[model samples]
Target: MSEKRKLAFSKANYLIMIAGIIVLAIGFIIMTLDSEPYGFGFLGLTLGPIVVMLGFAIEFVAIFYKPKSKSDTE
Candidate 1:
């Protein structure tokens, strides 16, 4: 891959990681702030973080977790 391609991939990976952290934080805040143990608002709050984490996980798989081809090793 070219240098530009590597840089672009790195940028995307960081963006996904940051997004995941933000989502997890939001979820934690919502879950903590709720008066009720379980409610729609609380559920909604949790969903944001869950989706963020999933996005991060998917990005991670696409980036750092992929199996390397023979060309990649060379």
Candidate 2:
């Protein structure tokens, strides 16, 4: 059996990941600032980690998953 090749990430994917990180940072800052309870800031606190984790999951999927080549179907 032949070995399969790994997929490589595109430049756009990296840019998206970077943007996600920036958004996550902003969310964290908003969450940490003094603010009223049960408000937008509190929402940020809940959303920040979820957004960051989603970003990482997207990156992981991009890096590890690929469609099989036509030749591989034989």
Candidate 3:
């Protein structure tokens, strides 16, 4: 008999990935909204990139995240 296989990622991981994508989009939008020429101002040069990096970090965490199984909880 063949055994059923479980998914590699859980629902929570997918949600976290979606959140990371949204954050990345927001960061790009922020950079676009910068008033300075050629995106040289703080938002474009600093804050936007920071947010983007954070988004990437979130995505990394999501990819590696492992939820505790019921057996582990008990």
RMSD values for the candidates in order, in angstroms, are: 6.6, 6.1, 1.5
The candidate that achieves the highest TM-score relative to the unseen native structure: 3
Model 3 scores what on Cα lDDT?
0.95
lDDT for each residue of candidate 1 in 1-74, tens digit (9 for 90 to 100): 56553353555566666776666676666555656556456445666457656666765654673434579877
lDDT of each: 0.59, 0.62, 0.95
Q: Write the per-residue lDDT of candidate 2 for residues 22-47, one digit (tens) a residue.
A: 76676566556636565455445566
On TM-score, the stronger of 2 and 3 is 3
The model with the greater lDDT, 2 or 3, is 3
How many clashing residue pairs appear in each of the predictions shown? 0, 0, 0
**Pairs in clash, predicted candidate 2:** none
Steric clash pairs (candidate 3): none
- Report the C-alpha lDDT of model 3 over 1-74, residue by residue, as the tens digit: 59988788999999999999999999999999999999999999999999999999999999999888899977
Ranking by TM-score: 3, 2, 1
33 in model 3: Cα distance from truth in Å? 0.5
- The TM-score that candidate 3 achieves is 0.89
The 10 consecutive residues of candidate 1 with the worst lDDT sum are 3-12
TM-score of model number 1 = 0.44
lDDT, model 2: 0.62
Those runs of model 1 whose alpha carbons end farther than 4 Å from true positions after fitting are: 1-9, 37-74
